[model samples]
Target: MSRRCELTGKGVMVGNNVSHANNKTKRRFLPNLNDVSLMSDTLGRTFQLRISASALRTVDHRGGLDAFLAKAKDAELSPRALKIKRDIAKAQAATAA
Candidate 1:
């Protein structure tokens, strides 16, 4: 699988690694990604996602998966996450109506 966070779209960053001799080599700063299961209250389901550590923390801080997705931008979400977001919205709307 690609090294990208499915939630926040965090990806590898390019940088230079400098040595003591002033030599620089290209390096990649990869985001710390983990496979996590987050529960969505609106959909009443758990989603398995590959996300960055910071994004995981943000999810918890925002209350849960549903809350985080509500605040997340569509451009930053993966296709799977975008689908889940739509499903959650539909479920919540169904409950409201």
Candidate 2:
């Protein structure tokens, strides 16, 4: 899999590393990603995602996986997360009906 955050779309960044002799080398700055299993209280299920540490903190700040998905922009989410968001919405609708 690519080194990218599924939630925040964070990915590797390109930069140059400078040495003491003013020599520069191409370098890649990778995002801090972790494979995490986030549980949903409404669906009573857990979803595994590869996300950045920042995204995890945001999820926690937003209260949970559901809340984060509900408020996050669709363009910022990965395809898997988009599907999960839709499923959560459908489940919530079913429970309400």
Candidate 3:
């Protein structure tokens, strides 16, 4: 996978660094990405993602991951992770029952 934030769509930006003496060099500004498992207060479950800190901040600002997730109605998620979350929910429901 590319070095990108799944939440904010942040990726490496290519640019040139110019010095006062007119010396130019290549540079890259990397996104602030972090892997975290966030529990959804609404779903009553957890999901992991490689998201940027800014996107995480937006989630926190809105309320939590749930709010962010709700807003991200079209966001993509890994199939394996989705299956794991579904299985966990099923198990929890079985236990509760």
Best model per TM-score: 1
Cα lDDT over the full model 1: 0.94
Question: Residue 71: error of model 1 in Å?
Answer: 0.4
**Candidate 3 lDDT, tens digit per residue, 1-97?**
7788776567899999999998999999988889888777645768778888888888789887655655553445345434544555566578689
Local distance difference test values of all predictions, in order: 0.94, 0.95, 0.70
Instruction: Tell me the lDDT of candidate 3.
Output: 0.70
lDDT of candidate 1 over 1-97, digit per residue (tens): 9999999999999999999999999999989999999998887778899999999999999998999999999999999999999999999899999
Model 3 spans with C-alpha error above 4 angstroms: 73-97
Q: Considering lDDT, which of the candidate structures 1 and 3 is the better prediction for this target?
A: 1
Is 1 or 2 the stronger prediction by TM-score?
A: 1
> Could you list the CA RMSD of all candidates, in the order they appear?
0.6, 1.1, 4.8
| lDDT value for model 2 | 0.95
Better of 2 and 3 by lDDT: 2
